[model samples]
Target: MPTALKLTTVQGNSLPIPGVESWHVTAKDPAMLVMTDFHWHSSVTVSENSTIDAALDHMKHTGVRCAFVIDGKMSAVVGMITAYDISGEKPVQHMRLTSTPRNEILVKDIMQKMADWHVANLKDIESATVAEVLKVFTDSDVTHIPVMEKNANNEQRLRGLLSFAKVKRLLVA
Candidate 1:
């Protein structure tokens, strides 16, 4: 026979939560300044078939400048869309080329395909400084870039994203 264990009454109604500490970051600091680690955060995503306006609206609502494009079942990332891609000349170019109205243009029409995306290895990013990552943003002339890592199966997967806008916000101007 097992003996009954004593239970203690709850002391407080509130539970402790993780605290966010603000830090002054320099270029020489860790590249965590701009990284949106998916391990700890959710990635904003949209469907490829969604309208450009819809995608832009979602991004705006989420206060994000970019979103990952997902497949039909929302299973995998198929591409990426940025506020610039929707608001820039790409929309107009697509409208003129395909004779499709602006409203009819879909995210897939303007989003950069995943296969064409330039990515950084997670290992490199792990040891990189803010300035080094910033150099990549400058050299690539891109506001965002995905960081990739290999799984136990040896297949590449998205680990996180680095955003120049985030970097500017965290580092001293």
Candidate 2:
């Protein structure tokens, strides 16, 4: 005979996403929120061909909601994958857009392409304090922003990533 399983519950206060709306800034002190001051989402990455399930696993272990989709080893960051991208309507949209079955969908299919994402310039990120990066969140519907840096070749390279959660957590605190 086996013993019955047991579970317990814990309670805590919740942090709310700042700003009344996507374009609004309801935080009392937006200046205290700097993208650099917060953690960026560039550490964990996944291949574009990885399945949504795989991306989810990576995020789960990394404690991040987003992953930069890399093409290959040391490759330029191509796209981004987030929990929302997988758990949200993106998969359904991908199915509709590509006529692919749910099982056939890959991260690449639903990832926000490089061309579709707006980024903060590395220089601006280095110089700007406060929640200037909040505008990136406000201007777009995305919770993450891929920051780009222009290198010696005058080409934009993947620098880091910013997310709305980090900004809002600090701002609302």
lDDT agreement with native, every candidate: 0.89, 0.74
Q: How many pairs in model 2 have backbone atoms within 3 A of each other, for residues 3 or more apart or on separate chains, i.e. clashes?
A: 0
> Once model 2 is optimally superposed onto the true structure by TM-score, how far is the C-alpha of residue 43 displaced, in angstroms?
2.3
TM-scores for every predicted model: 0.86, 0.69
- Cα lDDT for residue 61, model 2? 94
Which residue pairs collide, candidate 2?
none
Worst 10 residues of 1 by lDDT: 15-24
User: For model 1, how does the per-residue alpha-carbon lDDT over 114-146 read when each residue is reduced to its tens digit?
Assistant: 987988888888889999987888888688899
What CA root-mean-square deviation does each model show from the true structure? 4.6, 12.1
Among all windows of ten consecutive residues in candidate 2, which has the lowest summed lDDT? 30-39
Off by over 4 Å in 1: 1-23
Number of colliding residue pairs in each model? 0, 0
Give the best candidate by lDDT: 1
What local lDDT score does residue 152 receive in model 2, on the 0 to 100 scale? 92
